[model samples]
Structures are given as structure tokens and as C-alpha cells.
Target: MGSVVFSIDAELGWGFHDYSNPPTDRIESARPGWKTLLEIFETYNVPATWAVVGHLLLEDCNGIHADHPAVDGWFARERGAWRDRRDLRFGPDLVEAIAEADAGHEIGCHSFSHVLFDDPRTTRDIARAELETAIEVARTFDIEYESFVFPRNAVGHRELLAETGFSCYRGAADPPESRLRRPLEKLLATIDPQRVELVEPTVDKHGLVDVPPSLFCFRFEGMPRAVVETLAEDPIVRQAKHAIDRASRTDGVFHAWLHPNNLQAERDARRMESIIAYAAEKQATSDLRIETMADVAERAQ
Candidate 1:
């Protein structure tokens, strides 16, 4: 049988720290969705890889970015101490909840501070520091990360990841030809969502399993939002179910990923539930197997 892997980019505000005006309201609004995700996975007995930011596991920080590299010539602005920004910066409680969940989820690293490893500014020292800090912080919770998801999906520093004991990393899907291609594709998806390509996990030169993503559970907004919401069904759910079915028939891997923050509205959560329920149903009948990124990596090895 084929397999399906779900990976959640579980970074709170750290995902947007580089933005001039971070969406504080949206970030806070999505906090509850994290717990909702755990509950949903429990309901379906579906485990996922939660690639958490290292900083989120911290109780407090000095509110400084002196150790990390500067992105685009400016360092990440720390408004105040981490204590005051607990909702955004610190989330050990949320990480603990994922660890305590009954679904047997895997907690992996998403860098220390969402630093883009692919950027030229991110030197070897910076990359090493990020991985080291992430490993150190996760150790406090008795968790040893074996899966690494690059920040912003801008992959880099593979040797460092393998040296740090990570066995696998998620790779991006096919790149769009142009910037406009993505927005245009999103709009077109509202009409008829395409089936995502399935991949077989491959072992790279660095000895890390490359579990590339099949699709991103993109959130519709603006005009596309209106069109999607008015539709009789969810295109995202339809697309995911189709991909899962195709994977089962082809004996390939279907990997679906999204941010918990994407579950902003009730409808968004319902869409996720629909996709997971479909995958679980298929698994119950031996059509498809739901596995974590670590499981794929282990099997690939």
C-alpha cells in the first residue's frame, strides 16, 4: 500500500518575524487552532510531523537577535522581552500538548528562529547555530528531532542537518515558472483543483531522506475566498482526497502540509477534518497507510 504524510509548520509568530507589520491579530486568533489540530488528529488517529520553531519551546528569551544572521540587512526586531510576547514567541505549552497527544505525532525542528537557510546572508555559522539551538531546546522536553523542515521551505544546509542527526527533510514541490503563476494557479484551483503529484522517498547524497511535499493546503483569500466559500464543496478537500486515492493506486507517497494558523475559521478546520477523515477511512480498509515523516525516513533507510 502507499502512504500519506502530513506535516504542520508549527511556528507561531516566528514565521512572520521578518515582516515589517506582523499580523498579530491573526497569529493570536490561530493559537486555539493548534489545540484544535491536536484534537482532530486524535479523533482520526492520524499522526503528523509538527516541525516546530525552536524558540517556541522556550519559556523566555532576552529579546535579542545578536547571535543569528541578519536577513535583508535588518535583524528581527524584538519588541520586548519574550515574557511579554509569550503568545507569539514562546509556546512550550503547545509543544507539550502535541507530545502528550494520543495520536503519536512526531515533533521535528523548523530552525531556531525561522531563519531562511537558503538566503545568502545565512552563513554556515548561522545555520549551525540554528540547528544546534533547536536540538538543545528540544532535548529539554526529552525529544530528539530527526526530521527538519526548512523555514519558508527554502531548503539549504543539508550536510549540517545530517551531522545534527536529522534523518529526513521535506522538499518543495515543482517551482512555479513565475511569481504570478502561483496566484493564477490559486485562482484556477477554485474552479477545478488539480491532483498533486505523488513521490517516492529518496535517500540523498547526505544520507537524509528527501520526503518532498505533494501539496500545500493553501488558504484562499480575497476574491478567491468568495468564490471558494460560495462553492458547494471545498476544492482543497477534493484535491487532497484525489491525491490520496492516486497515491494508493500507484503505490506512491502523498504528502500534504499546512500551517496550523491556516485553520483560522471554522470552515478551514472542517476542510482539514474532511481531508483527514478521508485518509483515515482509506487506511482502515488497507488502501493507504498514514505515516509520519520519520517513519518514511526510517523505511527509506
Candidate 2:
């Protein structure tokens, strides 16, 4: 049996702080849709990894925000633009809900304030503070984060994750390499449903394991409604099925990920259910083990 890991980037408003709209308008918490996700996982007896933002653990911030060492603030703005808007950042209730999910579900780190580690403006001091603060805050809730998912998938500071005591991270996507016409390869990969290679968990020289993802959960943001509806097979579902098949045949790992907020839309939620149902079927019939990212990392050790 192959392994399948579901990683959720569990940040509410903090994940969408860049927007001028109040986080309430753009982001959501565990109350409405997120609770349903927990219920679904419980029904299927599925385990997942939730890479929670550190600030969300704080019991309602009374005008408290991270004192980032970077002059530009978290995003490098001179005046902490979103600091006073505590409602947009704090969500301790959601943190608790995730902790109380499936007994063996993993709680991983998604940075303290969704800091972009790949930004050139972000210094080592800033990165260190972010990582350290996440660890410190998680401790308050008694959640020791062993796996991490980089904010916006901007990976950096590998040694820092190991230093901060993380066992593994979700590495960047791996596309098939091609020597034949590069542009054609890109177009084909984009247009066709092809099998993506399942990542074999590998340990870095720094002792941090890389448990990369196989495919993304369904999202319909960029495509037009008409095009999406007209497609013979939902692209995301097809991709996920292909990955699952490849992994099952090869005894590989198929890791799928998405954000809690993605399920705020009913369409996205249905797509997620479809994917989860397929996963459940694979688990019952195949040796497809559905595990948390930390669980996979532990096996590698």
C-alpha cells in the first residue's frame, strides 16, 4: 500500500492579511466550514496535518501583535499596517478545534504570522523570530509542531526549521523533466491529465525530511466558470486520481493539500469530499495508508 497525506494550511485571516478588505470578508475560521472538515475526517477515520499559524492560538488579542524585528514589519511595511486589527489575526478557538480533531491528526507549523521566508527583504533575524515565535506560541497550547508547510509555498531557512525542532516540511512540486521542446512540455502538462511522480520521503543533510505533495485540492479561482463546467473531467480530480494510481502502483507517497478557507465555497467543499471519498476507497481496498505528514516523517526515521 502507498501512503497519502493531507496537509491543511490552517490560517484564517492571517493568511489573507495583505488584502485591504477586513479579514472577515475574505477569510473564515473553524466555526462554519472548518468544523465540517473535522466531521468528514472523523466519519472516514482519516488523519491529516494542519499547519496552523502561531498567532491563531492567542485567546483574542487585545491589540497585541508580533513585534517583528524587520523594519518593514511582517510584510516589510514601515508602520505595521494590520497590527491593530486583532480580529483579522487571532483565532484561538480554531486552534483548539484542530487540536481536538482526530486523535492522531498532526498539528504542524505554517510560520508565526504567515511570514514569507522567500522574500529578499526578509532577513535571517526576521526568519528566526518568526520560526521561534511559532514554536513558543504552540507550546502555550501544548502543541509541538513536528512538520511545517511554508507560507505561500515559499521555502527557505532549512537549517532554521531543523534548529527549531521540525522533523519535516512539504517540499516544492516536482514536474516531469523533458529534453524535447520545453514549451510544448509545459503546455502538455498544463492541458493534459498526466501522472505526477509520488515523492519518496527523503532526509536532508540538515536532518529535516522533505515530504513533498502530489497534487493540490480543487480550486476554481483562475478559470472561468463556463470552462470549468464544460470540462469532461474536473482537472483537479483527474490529477489527484492519476497521482493516487501512480502511488498505489509504485508504493509511493501521494500528499494532497489545501486551505480550510477553500471550503468556504460549497463547490470547493464538494470537490474536497469527492477527493476524500476516493481516498477512503483506496484505503479500504488498496494498501493506501492515509497518514499525517509527521507520521510519514517518523516512518522515514
Candidate 3:
């Protein structure tokens, strides 16, 4: 039997701290959808890995951490930017919700501040600090993280992750060499989407299981987002269902991921629910098992 994995990049505002003009509206829009997603997963009996930012688990912060790596104009220390924005930065309530969900979701790490590990600015010491902080914060919720998702999916300082007791991390998808390939894929998906890529989990040199994603759960950028609301079927949902079927037949893993913020739109929420429902149906009849990233890692081991 093949397995299906769903992982959510649940970073909230930290995911956008680096943006010059952060999408405040979009960030706020994502809050209500978190519960909606949890309900959907529960209904389908689907579990997922929620890779969260460390800071979000905090009850409160004093607005500065002297020990943190020195990034210029750090948003956390900018009183005007963050002092009154606690609603966006702190999400222990949401974390608790996921932990308490009946679907058996796993909580994983996504760094402390969403710092880019691949950036030269994030040295080995900084990376260690990030991991340590994340681990320390997770303990407050009585959670130990075995799965790690790179902030921005920019992989780096992986040995540090291994040293910090991480058992697995999400691997980046291989990008096409030709720049035009992306636009071409997007155009094709609009017409008739293809089955997403399937991957077998592998343990890398650092002894961390690499569970690469098959597809991101979002509509193509230039495509009409409202098409899902009007059409009888969504292209993205069709693509995901095709990937799940292929994975079952070939004994491969189909991993799909997205940010909670991606579910703000009503159409996007409906599309995600459809995908989850199809996966559940496949699990009932076919040789397809729904699994979390942690579950896949344990099986690989």
C-alpha cells in the first residue's frame, strides 16, 4: 500500500516578516480558516504535520531577544511593527487546537523566527540558536518535534538539525531547468492538470528522512481563482486525486502541502476539503494509507 501525506506550513505572520510589504490582510484572513481546516480533517479522519514557527507558541514576548541573530531591522524588535500585533504573532491557541484535534496531527518545527537557513546571514551558530529556541518553545506545549520544515523551504545547516534531534525534514521539489517550464506547467494545469510527482522517502547522510512534497495545494498564479467556485470540478483537486491514485498503484508516496493562509478564499477551502475527501475514499477501498510526515519517517526507519 502507498501512503499519502499532508503537511501545513503553519507559520502565520512569521512567514511574511521578511516581506517588504507584508500582506496584512491575507495574514488576518488566515486565522478563521485554521479551525475550518481542523474540522475538515477531523471529518475525513486525515492527519497532517503542522510545521509551526517557534515564536507563535509563546504566550507573550517582551518584544526583543538579545540572544537572537542580528538581522537588520528585525521585525520582532520593531515596537511599532510588532508590539500591537500580538494577534498575528502569537498563536498558542491555534497550536493547542491542532494538538487537541482527534485526527492525530503532528506538530513540527519551522525555526524560531522564520529565518532563512540558506542565507549567508544564518551561520552555524545562528542555526543552532534557531533550533534550540524552537525545541525549547515546543516543550512548553509538552511536544517534542521529530519533523522539521525549513523556513521558506531554503534548506541549509542540516547537520545542525540532526544534532538537535530532528528525525526528518521536508525536501524541496526539483525545479525545471528552463524558466519557461513553470509558466508552461501553469498553463497546462489550467486546461488539464497532470498527476503530481510521487516520491519514495529516503534517509539522507544526516540520518534525517527526506519526505519530498509531490504538489503544493494552490491554484496557479495567473489562472482564475474563482474557477473552482463556478466549475463542477477544480483542476487542482483533480490533479491531487490523480496523484493519489497513481501513488496507490505504483506503491509511491503522494505528499501535498500548503500554508493555512492559502485557505482564506472560500473556493480554496472547498477545494482542499474535496482533496481530503477523495484521499479518505481511496484509503477505504484501495491500497492507499493516509499518513503524517512523522508516520512516514517511522516507517522508513
Candidate 4:
């Protein structure tokens, strides 16, 4: 029985900085935000999944420089930042630090370059390669990870996930039926499982775990707490909580996710802190287990 999964996708911008390589951003640097989050989580003694992009797994910055620097999407270009001026050997240190601090903590994959899965159906080959590269990097780091969360929550390529030896993936959350759509939902008489499906850890015939990440809402740094409170009251949160709680009772798994960058935004720390506190406070210990997407998939198998 699992309680709830709290995971963080620590990653870079929309995609790889360079067409032929990955981002060169110092994503792992201990900025004020990272320090604040780490300190808070440490004090609270809460464990979360840190899913790193593949580029973050490497010790060297092989692809970031004046000759080539990650400017944007997986295949875009950008002018090199000052840090990029040095040898392209700046990334993944933050990931390594987290691994060293907590052995029970898990490292999952966010693809090699934070490849977007949303449309206008961006590059499919890049998505596959990013997924595959992330897997390879995870193995090289000896994490043996089985869970994947797409960058920006974009999802698709379910078959490719199964083929890549991943047991589970965190897909998009389903938007609850709007007030205007209530009549339709009643008429339909069923929730669209594909839109917000959560599966048992057991692998499919092809051996993939499907964990749908249904986000309630998110707020930036300066955004008021009133907004999230507004969200927590939404029937959707209660419904989602009930679903997860029931899963705990039924020997099924539950998961939820966030991103580190969300904390980097202005005034976002206060907003996210409230959420972290709420999630930590509401964490159920009953027949419930808390795990990262990777941890849940491993146990499911």
C-alpha cells in the first residue's frame, strides 16, 4: 500500500540548448531557492524523488560552448553564458549532491534534454532520443531508474516508454469537467481514464507503469496563497485525494509531482512552501506508502 508520491523534476529550460547536444545552464547550482527548499525539506524530514535531465547526469559539459550552446528546445541554439565560456563541464553536481545526502532518496529521469512532448507535435525523433539518452545516463549513474516524467508535463510516446525499459511514466493531469460540461459528464457516465489514469505498479504486458500526475494548480513566487487555497477547495483535489487514499487501501500506488524551477520564480517560494507544508502534513501513513515515481514502479514490479 502506498500513500502518496512526492517527486521533483529538477531540470533546465524548454529543451536542449544546442541542436546536437544538451543545455549548459547551471541548473544544479545552490541558488537561494535551492538552499531554501533543501533546508525546509530537511527540517521536515520529507523525502522526494529528484528526477534529473540526462544532461544533468554528466560530469562534463561536452556540448556547451561558443562553437555550440543550448539556446532553446532540444535542437535549438543560444549564445553561451559566462559559465559556458569555461570548458563545457558544468552540470549534474546538484544531482550528485542530493544522492549523497540521502540514500533512500531516488533519482528519476526527465529525459536527456527536457524534451517537450506537446504539440504542434514537436520532434518525435528527438523525444525518443532524449528518453533513451536519459535512460542511458541513469544507468551510467547506477540509479537503475524506471520512472519518467516529461518536461513541461507534456506526454505521449507510451509505446516508446515501454520499449525503453521504463516501468512507469508521469503524464498530464486531467482537467476536471467544467461547470458547463457537467451535463456532458453525467451523460457520458464515466471519467476519461486516459485523461487522468493511475495504474497499479504492476507492469503492463509490455512492462510499463502509467502514473498520471494530476496537478491541482501552481503559483508563482509573488502570487498570493489565496489562489492555492482556492484550488485545494476545488472538488478535484478532494476527488484526487480520495482516489489516492483508496489506492492506499487497495494496494495500489499514488504519485504527485513538482518542479524545482517553480520555486525559482518570484515570491513562488512562499506559495510552494505552503504546498510542501500541506503535502507533508497531509501525508498519510495508513496502509499508505510514500515513494518517488521510480520507487513506486520498482515496488509495483
Candidate 5:
């Protein structure tokens, strides 16, 4: 049986503050998306890893926030902008709901303020402070996060991750080695499955398991109505199924991931349902196993 590691980056507004059109009311926009996603997971009997932002675990970042002198200046304006608007930055209720849901889901850390680990400005001390604060906060909420997903998928301070006791993290998808196919792969990867051969989980230099993603659960809602409807029909869905088949046949891992905000639209929700149902079918007939990042990390140990 091959493994399927599914994860979701669960950061309400923190995930998209760098975007041009940040959500006006992040919590409200994220609520329905999370509600539908959990339902889909339960219905499909799929266990997912939800890598939550540390700040969202609290109702507000009023009292116990650690000060990172070096990194504080990195996103000063962005963070300060949302300081007064708790709804745009926090989601303790969402965290509580996920904890209560259980539903075979694993909660992992997504950092305290969604700091990009790969940013050159994020120093070792700053990274350590971020990781430390996230760990401390998770402990307070009783959320044992053994696996991590870097903010914006910007993987950095990996040695720090292992040092601070993380067992696994989602790495970038492997690119094609072929000069002729590399560009094609890059373009296709955004909308389809292109790296099935390299989707297998491997250990990093620090011995932390690297669970690379196979395909991004991309957004189609932003496309024209016709384009959205056409994509909803099969192109994207077929690629997902193909990846699952390749993984099952080769005894590899196929990890699919997306942000919760990706599910905010009804059309996108229904599209995701198709992918989940297909995975369930693969599990039933083929030797396909549904596992979380934590599960893979534990087995690796």
C-alpha cells in the first residue's frame, strides 16, 4: 500500500496578509471553509494534518507575546496594521473547534505570526524565538504538534526545526531534472500533477522526514465562469486521480495540500469534494493508505 499524506495550512488571515487583497473579516471568511473541509474529511474518513498559526490558538495576542527584536522589524507594518483588528488576525474559536472535532486530524504548528522561515532577514535567534513561542503556545492549548508546515511553504531554519523537536515538515516539490521538461513541469505543476516520481517521502540532512507535496489543491474560482466550470468538470480532478494511481502503483507517497481559504468558495468546495471522494475510492479498492504528516514521522522513527 502507498501512503497519502494530506495537510492543510490553517491560518485565518495571517496566511494572506502579504497579499494585495487581504480579507476584510478573515475569521468570518474562513469559518465556512473550515466547516466544509472538516465535514469532507469526516465523510471520506480522511485524516489531515492542520498546521495552525500559533497566534490563532489564542483568542487574542493581548498578553503573552514574546518580542523578537531582530525579526520584529521584518513585518512591523503588516503586523501592526492588524493589531487592533483581532478578527482579522486571531481565531481561538476556530482552534477550539478543530481540537474538539478530533476526527483523526493532527494539529501542527504554522508559526506564531506566519513568519516566512526562508526570508534572509529571519536570523537563527529570530527563528528560534518564533519556534519556541509556537511550541509554548501549543503546549498551553494542549496541542501536540510533531509535524510542521513552513509559512507560505518557505522552508528555512530546518536544523532549528529538528533541534526544537519537530519530526517532519512539508518540503517543496521536486523539479524535473530534464532541461527540456523542467519548464513544462513548472507550468504544469501549478495546475496539474508533474512530480509523481519524486513524491516519495525522504529524510533530510538533520534526519527529519521530508514529506513533499504531490499537487497543490489549486484555486479555480478566480477564473472566468466558463473556465471555472470546465476545470470543475475534469482537468484538475483527473490529474489528482492520476497522481494517486502512480503513487499506489509505485508504492510512493502522494501528499496534497492547500490553505483553508482555498475552500471559501462553494465551487471550490465542491471541486475539493471530488478529489477527496476519489482518494477514498483508491483507499477502498487499491492499496492506498491515508495518513497525516505526524503518522509518517512516527513510522519513520
Candidate 6:
């Protein structure tokens, strides 16, 4: 059996969402959190992937349209962190900082405007336009991002990806429910990402090596860390990771990911560090072919 493929994603959106107020995580929590995680990977010499948003690469969009009812209401409802502010300007030089930090690492695409592909009319032209935007931003830093991780873990628009000249798509993974559903999710949540096998119909059916890691190893966005840590002892995350660890049918890849914002809590930093340490131990103990999304995607070609 070949080794496993490991990937990490830092989802850089515009903001976070709070049920009663705007999310306070995007700038304050997520960006720095990711910086710390990336440093961890660097220190361990771990080859990881950063599935970044194009908005983070571009110069902040200036001039908010608060006059427009829709624009004003959008930020009000979803107060989360993004690479840029609502009007397109960031509070600081975060965009440049990421580009500089991404040197020697795989800087992959999360889409130019994550919403473009969401459009039903996302033709090849529009798709390339969106992808090229990210490509162009990467180019500004002299980094060529060929790998792609679809925004929202939605990689259905393979047409756009392939049309834009991408080699692979890193999409969603199997839910823990099918196998040891409960326990797996719990353990995986704490130890590693709950990265089940890729059980969905994606680019693979069309002969593409759709690279997906185990997922749902943790609670998704807006879910509190207190709730997630409580569920760490839950049966779901545990069963999921156990299945992956002992599976005879494990593939050339073992992948899992989540937004860094999910780890915004004070204690989450410790939890995330533990997870990274565990993955490092896994690499030492096994011959698993752990990799960044870019590495596997390039291999698919």
C-alpha cells in the first residue's frame, strides 16, 4: 500500500458569521491562527497546502456601497473575517504578508471570486476568468498556483477547473456516519481531521484523481469549540479515524481539512497543535505518502 496524503486548508473569507452579532474571528483570530499553523508545518518540514481565496491576493477593494441596501445588509448579517474588508480594503498588509509567507510552499487556488462558480451561468469563460484571477495574484508574488480547492468544499464545477487548466480538484470527503460514524468523528476531531474515504461522485468518475481527505472530523463554521471539545469524547469522530487507521482499503491518499476560523477559541490553539503533533507522529510511524494538495494534484496529471 502507498502512503497517505495529508492536506490543510486556511479558508480566507471576507468575514465570520455570528448568530447575534458579526463574527469576530476573520482578522483577529483566523489569519494569525493560520500563520501559526503554517509555521508549525514549516518547522516540521511538513509539505502542506494553503487553499486561499483570491480576494486575499488582490489589492483590497475600495469604496463600499453601503448606499446599496444589499451591500450594507450583507456585512451586517455575516460578520466574519475575510482577506479584505467589506469595501475591499484590509486593515493592514495581510494580503502581502500571506504572499510572502507562502514562499517555497504550494500556493493553490480557492477561486478568484468564490461566488463566480456558484453561478448557474458559470461557463468556461467565466470559470477561467475566476481562476485566472487567482493565478494572476499568485503570479504577482511569482508563485504559480496550479492546484485548486473549491470554496465551501464544493468542487462540483470540474468543468471550470479543467477548462482553466488545473490538474486536480481537492473536494469534500466521506462523512463518518457510514463506518464508525460517531466515535470516529470524535477522535478524529481531536487527533486528526475526521478524514474518511472519498465516497462521493466527483471528478474521479471522469478519470480525474479527485484528491479529498477525511472530513467532518470536527464541527463546521460557527460551531463553538466548547461544543466541539465536548464532542471530542463523542463516538462519531473516534470511529471515523479508527476506520481510517485500520482500513485495509486505504488509498494513495488520506486527506482532511477545515477553515482555520473554526479554531478561534483560546484553547483551540493547543488542540490544533496537538493534532499537528499527532500527524507528525503518524508520518514517523508509517510509510504513508503524506502530501500537500498541490503535490497530489500534480501527480494526477
Weakest lDDT window of 10 consecutive positions for candidate 3? 220-229
Residue 238, candidate 2: C-alpha displacement in angstroms? 2.2
Candidate 3: list runs displaced more than 4 Å: 76-78, 176-182, 189-192, 219-223, 227-232
Q: Candidate 2, overall lDDT?
A: 0.75
Estimate, for each residue in 82-192, the C-alpha lDDT of model 1 and write its tens digit. Answer: 236678888999999999988999999999988988888888988999999889989999999999999889989999998989999998655565245676664674445
Residues 1-301 of candidate 2 have per-residue lDDT tens digits of 6888999888777787655554563365434556677767777778889898887887655333457675433453213655665555677777786677664688899998787888886788888988998899889988888999999888898889998899999987543353354865554554455645577899999998999887767433445434755866666777777777766667789899888776766666667777777888887888788889988999997
lDDT at 143, model 5 = 76
Q: For candidate 3, lDDT tens digit of each residue in 1-301?
A: 7989999888778888777788876688667767788888999989999999998999987767778775766654335576788877899999999999988999999999888889998889889999999899999899999999998789999999899999999997545442356766656744464646788999999999999988888745334645553775677788888888887787799999988888767777888899999999999988899998999999998
Question: Which candidate, 3 or 5, would have the higher lDDT against the true structure?
Answer: 3
Best candidate, TM-score-wise?
A: 3
TM-score for predicted model 3 compared with the true structure: 0.93
The CA lDDT at 231 in model 3 is 74
* Model 4 per-residue lDDT tens digits across residues 131-231: 76777767776777777777767776767877777778775655445335665553232222223334444455567766666443241112333454455
The residue-level lDDT of candidate 5 at 301 comes to 66
lDDT of 4 at 263: 53
Relative to the true structure, how large is the alpha-carbon lDDT of every model? 0.84, 0.75, 0.84, 0.56, 0.75, 0.53
Report the error of model 6 at residue 270, Å. Answer: 2.3
Give the TM-scores of the predictions, in the order they appear: 0.91, 0.85, 0.93, 0.66, 0.86, 0.69
Q: Write the per-residue lDDT of candidate 5 for residues 1-301, one digit (tens) a residue.
A: 6778778988777777666666655445665788788888888877889998887776554433547644445444345766676765667777776777746789998987788888898888888988888898888888777898999888899999999999999986444453356754544644554534426578889989988887677632344434645655545566677787876676788788887777656767777788888888888888888888988877776
- Among all windows of 10 consecutive residues in model 6, the one with the lowest summed lDDT is 63-72
